[model samples]
Target: MTWEEIAKAKKASVDDAIPSEWRLEKNPTANKVRNVGEYLDETLPARENSITSCTVTELAGKISRGELSAIEVTKAFCHRAALTHQLTTCCSEIFFERAYKKAEELDEYFKKNGKTVGPLHGVPISLKDQVNLEGIDSAIGYVSLVNKPKNKDEVSNIAKILENAGAVFYVKTTTPMAMMSGCTSSNIYGYTYNSYNRLLSSGGSSGGEGALIGARGSPLGFGTDIGGSIREPSCFHGLYGLRGCSNRLPYCNVTNSFAHAPVLASVIGPMAWDLDDLKLVTKLIIDSEPWMDDPKVPPIPWREVTDYPKKLCFAFVSDDGAARPHPPIERALQMCKDALVAQGHEVIDWEPPVSFIECRDLGASIYGADGYKEIADECAKSGEPIVREVMVLAGNGTDLPIGCSHVHEHWEQNKLRYEYQQKVDKYWKSTAQQTSTGRPVDAIITPLWETCSFKCEDIDMFSSAYSSTFNILDYAAVTTPVTTADKTLDSKDETYTPISDHDRAIHEYYDPELFHGTPVGLQVVTPRYEEERAIYLSGKLRDALSERR
Candidate 1:
């Protein structure tokens, strides 16, 4: 079969898997509905609406107390998730029957034992397409990988940990081909629209997870980040996403593009609607001692950080110098600074000795070290063109990248990465002299992207300067949603001059009308292996922002 034929059959199969009653009567086109999240909330039956709206913690608590059954929670999420997929194309795999079976078992266990199986008993959790599951395809948006399903031996370690905690999985979300784009789109699943605003791109490669959770199809889900996959989508949807340091959470058995790329490693983490829920899942996985099963993971126990200082200092980066953030982002940053200051915390301008431009360029070279050969080879198996959004990885979306010709050249790039890390680490330590608390800044707050989100096809127009720099530094970071784009409050700058050609393109791309109502968020950064501290600061910031409002 042609690639198109294979893609059609795969899509059909997913649609068929959804029970007929759960499917939407008509899928709304972009012109008809711009916010599928609000659409679903208004249309779903009251019981399903309330069930899906509950947080991970809330659902788990109710189930443990027997106020809600595992089967009912699973059924509600399945119905809502099926409708979400129909509207946004967010799901890559749909297996409601399997989820129901799991839920039934959990319910039965509770009835017989007089107690819940685990903390997450009966709660529905979604997975990105990259997470392996038995009898399901990880596919990661390659049509060539569609028919081939995973076996029992191939289940991801993280999935196993969650299942042990009594989590139920119903669907796996979509991604760009080979999980290689900033926006999710592939020949197999097409563009996964933003649940908040369907006309905009749902940031990728975790884009589908963003769309699903943003639409409240699932309370919480897992997404992997090589550069900014987890953070960008989280920012776009007003969700909290953790991009933990490398192997802080297990990636064992997870399908990925560069499974063994040694120069720069990708990390898997959680994205959730509530700050406490994000913390709960992170600690739960860490508490499982994942290192015993996945040697790559560090054996760091979940450190509870309850004794933090009352007055914390934060470093704020207003611009990355490569591309100036759009108006909404500028306003959001100011709002954060003001909120923290009002809470008696110190917020200072950050001037790192190293440049984000240097870090980002080095990351690009490392990511393309193999010239994206794996992506090309996989596409060749079924003959699907690389999705247009990912063409920037290759030359201008047309020519393939010129890879390093020798192992030594790759080593030089890795060497440069280490040097960058050291310089930034030193600079961060040097900040002790600048703060009133006589310590390094607790965390650095900055924009995740220059804009809240862009039109689906315009992803290539923006640079990954803000988020990818942290990835290269190997720092633990989390995204915190601040506010939304308001046309009246965030007008385009008429007097600002362009700094560079790329900056000019980004500056010219802004239209207050086009981006209104989209979510805006900033990332909180801490040193390497500091996921706990990063998440703590993020929650504090969320509190400050809420109190200010």
Candidate 2:
């Protein structure tokens, strides 16, 4: 069928599936648009200029001291998120009514008990679309998945923990179709944009969460990362995002693709505006003992580690040795190096031997190993048009199903990945020889991707090797925004030469002028299951950069 025919059929199917109770009787209120500055001005008092600038720790302290009520704090965030979603299309579902009700409950609890409800009491949290809420749709950008009632109770372990701890759920965010690519777009939501610059993408499949937090719409949110889904968007929007070790947080009841396929290195974790908030959310979830409910989760408790030495070491890589980063990304790396050195930390050039190409190719094979026949079957059930990126994964219309032999070949690849992990561990251990403190680097700093952020059609050209390489190695990676895209300084180099058509096309997407003020992010990577260490190191890096400024 033609594209037009497909579009009409999909619309009709969606209309037919809408619940009778939810069918609109009248037009809904038109969404409002506002920038970050305008939003802060309207919601906060004259003396509260810093309200928009403060971290979650500061906000929590104020609430605890009775200077702010839960309802007031929650309202500020919900209003801001509504505006952000209007401008950037960051939300897949909005629950302002429910959030307000929860906020009121939190306020009553504090008043009666004379204490805070929990560590994150009154804080508004956003979630990626895949997380299950009792009544909310867990539609991860597939029209077919929309409005489908859960077979059982949809109270995800993570959601239960957050609710018990006093978090007010204001919104559930969007993702790309099947969340298969790094750009956020789907037939259901169209596209999500960077709040900082409307022309650029927010990054995906956690793009909506990234945009929401970056715009200060919510203080904290959760996103999942398979191939830089969390880290890339976090970097693109200038926020703090963590791709924790798989199973560190509960994943049970969360909707995902290829449910029958053996798990790979994908993980779910928090995204926030500041490092301290990231720590706050991480501690709460891990302390909640998610393993009790989700069999897949490991029984690991959050550990409080002491601070490292004053002088620390870092291994820096501007690129994954696959493709060079754009000018803005290059500048962000330099700024980080300079900031660290100025703070009395040791910085050294890193040249790891692993090939990012191999890492990315293998990861893609794992993702498409089923040849997406299952995904196509699901799409057909609802008669929703397959998204463009999903088409890419289906591989040039072949759509051929992979047999048992292909599955066995993937098992062989998994063994090779295990071998690769050992080599990386050895390489990290050897870094001690080059450090003045005689200890290996605390973390490796690398770009999240080769570009700041891309437009929709341009996303296919860029490889997610920078972040995906860490996933393949099963290392913990944290994304921290360093600077904004500066068009004058970030222009494409005229002297640049292409390694291939893909390389050149990727380079051509860098319109620094269009991407100006967009967040340029860096990744901090540590060994697997080292979330505490990762969080601590991320805090140190945030402090180091703040001190420099």
Candidate 3:
């Protein structure tokens, strides 16, 4: 059959498979349904207020003070998430029933003990579809993988830890096919849009999680990053995300694209609306000792170090020269540097010893070495058109797959990555001598991407050296929004000179007005495996920016 014919058949099959309860009236008028928020307030008592408007900490305080019950909190989040999914197409599976049941159990425990279950007690958390939860599908946007029953009790390492700590799970969020693209759209659930704008991209492969959190559907969620997956979406949606050192959070039961790839760079980490929430979730997850359950996890617990001095050293980089950041991003970087200097923190211009361009290329080769044949084969079964971003990176479904023999070359690249990391380490160490604090820079503040959220087709040509370089070095990186895209400050640089063809295209893609109000995020980088420090410093940086504003 022709591709168009297959696409039609797939759509028909999917339509027929939808449960009757989920079907909507064709061309229904506004009168046919209540606004989701209003419906939730009417049906659920806890949702009389907006659950999305509060932070995880605020919710915890309410629960502890007896002002809220676990069931009430879970229901409020579920209601909001259901609405978010409807608006942004963020959720892959709804687990409201299971979440409510768990919430009831927590309430019962509290009633008997006169105390909450744990730190995360009644906090509702969303998971990417890659994290398996027993009966739920772990399709990761591949229809061929759908409906495959879990052979074993498929509990994710992170889920197990969170469950033990009393966190509630309400929904499994969506992802892109193969989870390799910068935009989230799949044959399984359709396109996910920016909750803030809807007309623009949400930034992916963690796009759904970003949209859900940004829309206030869930206060906290988890997303994995290999390239810019976690950070880019977080940046675009105005959320704080940490791409922790690989193995800091367990990934054993989690499904991903490079399942068998020897050079493991991708990592799963937390996403939150606020920096404190990110820190709270990170501490709770790490304290659970993921190493016990997942052999690959390192034995790193939450460090209670308060060693950060009042004064800090910061390194700032606006452009990596691989892809010059758009005007708004450059301004955001300058604003952050100025804020830090005004706060009495030492700021230094950083030119890394090694080129970021080389790192970006190496990272892409490692990630796309399979030539995405696995993704294509999976997509063929689903018969969904490849999303614009994926097509740009891997071409229109005709690229040949990389041969198995290339594995040896991939191994050599991994070794080179180690050497590159050591060079970074040396550079970081050298900063101590140049600072008044007598310590190396606490973190390097850099732009998360060239644009707030690039047009889907432009993502392939846009260099993601900002986040990818950290991944190559296995450094802990935290992303925080400094400002949104402001048309006045983000005006095009008419006098700008092209750094390269790729850089010129990236420059042309910028539209200050189009991206207005989109989050412009900056990264805070710390040493490898020092996730606690990264979180704490991110909190400090966030506070500094807030104070300035």
Candidate 4:
């Protein structure tokens, strides 16, 4: 079969896997279905609607107490997931039958044992396509990888961990080819649109995960991040996503590109509609001692952080010094600052010792250290053209970057990354002298992107400096939704002058009307291995914002 035939068949298989009863009679277009979550709320049966509306913690509690059966919960999510995929193209693989069977088994275990199997007993969890499952394809948007199923030995460690805790998996979310792009568009899945506003691009790599969870197709899901794959999508859809320090969460057996790259690594974490749900899963995974299974994972047990100074200090990064944030992002930052101040928390300007510009450039150099040869070879296998959005990673959008000429060049990038981390760490510590509490600021809050999101075709014009800088520092960051883009409030600044050509393009791309209704989110970043603190601070931020609301 031709590559086009393979891609079509793969997509058809996912659709075919959905039961006819669950399929939408007429799939809605972006214009007609701007917000799928709301659409589903009004259209779904009352029971399914209520079930999908509950947070992961609520669902688990109901299932544990016999108020809801595992099969029932699974059915609700599976149905919603089927509809979400049809509307957003968010799913790469759908196997509701398998999920049902597992749910039944879990129910039987509960009946015989007189107790829940685990903390996550019977909870439905969605996974990115890179998460391998036995007999399922983790093709990750490569037509050449279609039809190749993973073996039992190849299952991702994260999947195994979740399953052991009685989680049921029905669908695998879509990803870009080789998981190398910022927007989720590939030859196979085409594109995964934002769930809240289908007209916008779902932030990539984990774009499908973002869209699915944004639409509440599943209570919670997992997304990986080397460079904002998880945070961008979460921010785009108004969800909470964790990008823990490198190897803080197990990545063992997960399919990925640059798997052997020594200079940088990707980490997998949870994305959810509720902060508590995100906390529950992150702690559960850490409590499971995943390090015992994945040697790379450090044996740092989940730290439950509760005691913080009544008057906390926080560092706020308004811009990256190159590209200024669009109107909505700027307003969101002000909202956060005002909320924190209202709560008696200190909000200080953050001027890191290492420039974000340097971090971004270093990240790009390391990302293209091999000139993306693996990506090219994989696409070449099936004679498919590289997706345009991903072309920039190759070089100048027209040619592949020349890989490092020597091993020493690769070492230099690694050295620079380490140096940047050291500088930032020192600066964070130095802030204690400026803080009223004589302690370093509790966390640094910054924008996830210059704009909340952009049109699907304009993805190539955006820069990732806002998100990827943390990746270079190996910091733990959590995305928190603050507000929506409001045309009446967030107008483009005509008086501002661009500092650079890249900045000019980003500045000129802003249109209040076009970006209106999208979610504007920011990231709460903590030091490496401080996932607990990062999440705690995010909860604090949410509380402050809620009080204001």
lDDT of 4 by residue, 171-263 (tens): 999998888888999998798999999989998989999999999998899999988999999999999999999898899999998887888
**Root-mean-square deviation of Cα positions for candidate 2 versus the true structure, in angstroms:** 4.5
Backbone clash pairs for candidate 3 read: none
Task: Go through the candidates in order and give the C-alpha RMSD of each one to the true structure.
Answer: 1.0, 4.5, 4.0, 1.2
Q: Point out where model 4 deviates above 4 Å.
A: 402-404
TM-score of 1: 0.99
Tens digits of lDDT, candidate 2, 132-172: 88767787877666766455477677887887887888888
- What's the lDDT for residue 541 in model 1? 98
**CA lDDT scores, all candidates in order:** 0.91, 0.77, 0.78, 0.91
Residue 386 lDDT, candidate 3, scale 0-100: 59
TM-score of model 4 (CA atoms): 0.98
* Model 2, global lDDT: 0.77
Error of 1 at 121 (Å): 0.2
